[model samples]
Target: MKTIAVLGLGKIGSLAAVLLRQAGLQVTGFDQAAKALHDIPVLSDDISSPEVLKCLCADHDAVLSCLPYHLNAMVAAAAHQAGIHYFDLTEDVSTTGFIRELSARGNSLMAPQCGLAPGFVGIVGASLVAGFDECRSLRMRVGALPQNPTGLMGYAFNWSPEGVVNEYLNDCEVIEDGERKLVSAMEWLETLYIDGVKLEAFTTSGGLGTMCETYHGRIANLDYKSMRYPGHVQLMNFFFHELLMRERRDIAGEILTNAKPPVDQDVVYVHVAAEGLVSGALRRSEFVRTYRPIEIGGKPRTAIAWTTSASVVAVIEMVRNGSLPQNGFLKQEDIPLDRFLETDTGRLFN
Candidate 1:
């Protein structure tokens, strides 16, 4: 864990490398084209080839992938062959399943969905459930929005459009009425308010990660949703369903990103709640936060970029220092929220 290779040096990936390097790890970044970073060294290489990926991973203590979800399975397989811990911010359910299979055969740790909703939100939800004697339900929601939103959609493409589109179209996993079932995304729409800001939430895939399996028989109701300004879901449904853009994910991503590119000023909203009987009495616990862009590395980063980067970097910090298990599949719920908040990079969440 002393040396790490960060693959895909995009905005979030580049920032993750910087945070890890700042925390005193020997970090190297791999991408198609090397971007000039102040202190950290980035290498340009064709990692799409499996041989190149394996050779690159063989040199590092761990490999943190920031590549697209479609490529994570290949990168993870390479890391497993190289015998190093593998981490990624992927929310693709199939990709995570592939990583889970690889983790069983390798001695190194394999952790996926280690960012934002699937990462930090799961940690918070598990912490809240710990207070109840018998937990009945847990609800988690997160949103990355433009601070000053415009248009009927009232949204911005601050994250990967392919990821967003996939979430919107994929089947979501939820434990409802004591049954773990798959439901259509964008269904189960509900309205919620965080800090007096009105928002709408709906079921989204991969936001729950592996929580449904971990709490399958223990909890009666468990779900995760994506929050957005009001009327966002309806327009998205029209764009994807009526317009038939769901089949054209690549073109849809290009269209959406072209229309609503990443914004410098954005906000991340998180709402998590758990309910059950505590000491034989019904009770509820909630964790709500409104996070905005902050100054990092002498520049302002978008809320989505930093929050997503910090969560994974903090987890890496914990693993490097033995705060987290070093081998096998790492589940988000297994991470302690308090301890996670204490890491140098984790302090950003606080």
Candidate 2:
């Protein structure tokens, strides 16, 4: 069995460690808060110390980082120096660029943005794109929403509040007219119905990581958006643009964190649609999935936590089994959707 060290024993990391252990992989968890879960062994150490991070990664076959986006660079560097594979659930584009640079110089695999939006959505989008002879347009949308929302925002904090703020403030990347371009977040708003529920989608940053570069000249129009209920975007626009919260992102994050209630009974919605020429006719392909909270390792976990963790863990399993490249920067689109769904970890998203 391969030994894997998981850094940051927070909600997602704790569940990931449990899933890894249940899969027969030796798991060691580390966190600064001294947090411990049911059966996983944890080390309470300062991960900010370079020596501590190196020591923890030196002996493990691979290290999965569940820490905040800013802390990923240090852990990724340590993993590279230790010659161990590195995986993370970061949706930060700058952090992923740093990891990609590290992967170019290192001999181990580095995979970032291994979560719901950029992870599985990319896989599904790629599959849809592959079915087309001449791809014209592609749109990917994903959301983690409360089953019963009672807040004014019509949303709950199912994941990191900081991540939510960052996506709203950063510029989104897209391919328009077969050219790569940067667009403002929260723009190009559109409404769509899913399962008889009306929801809205808008441009979001880092959700389409590296796909713009991959399909730049091939697809005429390509973009990724975050799905939310109607009126959510208007309130956010008022908060960030009208109220100048974008200038004070830290305060904005704190305000959202303190105000928004965290919901465990949430649902993850994924939808990818592609329109292009198939054979000799114009056709469209789509993939849609909705996931609810489920029990793992005899403990109940939220839909966001399990889905995000499952994606990274499934990629790790593929790398360990020689299905994915062992040494290089890995893209989520490179993992086929069907093959991924067949894995024990990836089955959760199915």
For all predicted structures, in order, the TM-scores are: 0.99, 0.98
lDDT of each: 0.94, 0.89
TM-score, candidate 2, is 0.98
User: Model 1, 73-131: lDDT tens per residue?
Assistant: 99999999989999999999999999999999979999999999799999999999988
Error of 2 at 344 (Å): 0.7
lDDT of 2: 0.89
Best by TM-score: 1
Which regions of candidate 1 are displaced past 4 Å?
Answer: none
What shift in Å separates residue 168 of candidate 2 from its native position after superposition? 0.3
Q: Tell me which residue pairs clash in candidate 2.
A: none
Task: Name the 10 consecutive residues with the lowest summed lDDT in model 1.
Answer: 49-58
By lDDT, who's the top model here? 1
